[model samples]
Target: MTAREQTEAYEDIPGTWVFDAQRARQGYHLNEFLYSLMKAANRAAFLANEAEYTRRFAMTEAQRTAVLRRDWNKLLELGGVSYALAKLAFTDGKSYQYMASRMTGMTEKEYVEMMLHGGRSPDGWRSRAERQGRA
Candidate 1:
């Protein structure tokens, strides 16, 4: 398939975001700011003043707002790579499981229980077209 066709195919997948070139370019600054949290001093500055520390990056206003709100799913929608976004979770002294639970709109205990029960079923609408009854 052509690259455009491949990209469109990726778009059809429900609840999935491909970190393709377009997303990489769009999230560059946002990811950079997230990764910056790896530094102790940077984390300290961020903890001290989230809005101020966020201003140092060239992130979009929406990205800044999502970061401030700790909106994990919104960050993903905004093109943030999950791995990079994990830095923010860690900076907040939370576990990856906590961030992941938030992403799925579940409490950590619910997420853990779901995982223990063999995880989400793969039988449900796997794509937007399927969900919309077009496929």
Candidate 2:
């Protein structure tokens, strides 16, 4: 079907034309339905990338699926490098650092410092602390 025909069909459906009433009343058109579709696509892409990253990084099967589903809370529960994996899926290394800072309760400077120092050692924070104390 044509674009206009498709839009008309969409409007004919009950509770589907989110933009129609608002656009009519306001005399300004905003394609809310199209925007929603784009947002969903973007989210799906992000989830797919998260899955790939988890798989490549050797995450647990359950954890990999959780990231693939964009279950952010489940990702946090997985801990270790899961947060870093999420950031990597979303951005480049520098942007990931900024995003990690925003999402993980750390300052941007702190995030950068951690990256510079090689963030999240394999043994994690407890091992790092012990090693530091011994030095």
Candidate 3:
């Protein structure tokens, strides 16, 4: 029926973001704001008054909340690109592992151990379709 509905058929991969057409459109403003932090001046302004800064970028209230909450999963669900989100993470002086740990619901130490042990167990991880007995 729509481009978004078309993607509903295949975007069921577990524990991942696809950055599909729908997501790209949805996250455009958010990703733009994240990417804008590439400049030190912009980053400074953002850190100064986040709410005002978000407003300046025309970011949705949900996006503002996701940023303020540092809710990485919610940000992704709101169409944020992992690569772009990394800029914000770096601005906060966080490591990629830190972001990954947050996304996976693991403490950094536990996540590091899991990585050392060859990453998370795939058990109990399923797509929406699989969970719904569609796949």
Scanning candidate 1 in windows of ten residues, the lowest lDDT window is: 122-131
Quote model 2's TM-score: 0.26
Q: Per-residue alpha-carbon lDDT of model 2 for 1-135, expressed as tens digits?
A: 976776666554331222344333432111121122234554465445644433334445665565455444344444423333444344332455565575546788987898789885644223334445542
Superposition error at 124 for model 2 (Å): 30
- For each candidate, the alpha-carbon lDDT, in order, equals 0.92, 0.44, 0.85
With candidate 1 superimposed using the best TM-score fit, by how many Å does residue 6's alpha carbon deviate from the native?
Answer: 1.4
TM-score for candidate 3, residues paired by index: 0.84
lDDT of 2 at 65: 64
**Model 1, residue pairs in steric clash:** none
Q: What is residue 81's positional error in candidate 3, in angstroms?
A: 0.3
For model 1, the local distance difference test gives 0.92
Q: 32-119 in candidate 1: lDDT tens per residue? A: 9999999999999999999999999999999999999998888888889999999999999999999999988899999999999999
Candidate order by TM-score, highest to lowest? 1, 3, 2
**Could you give me the TM-score of model 1 versus the true structure?**
0.93
Clashing pairs in 2: none
Q: How accurate is candidate 2 locally (lDDT)?
A: 0.44
Best by lDDT: 1
Q: What TM-score goes with each of the models?
A: 0.93, 0.26, 0.84
Every candidate's CA RMSD: 1.4, 21.9, 2.9
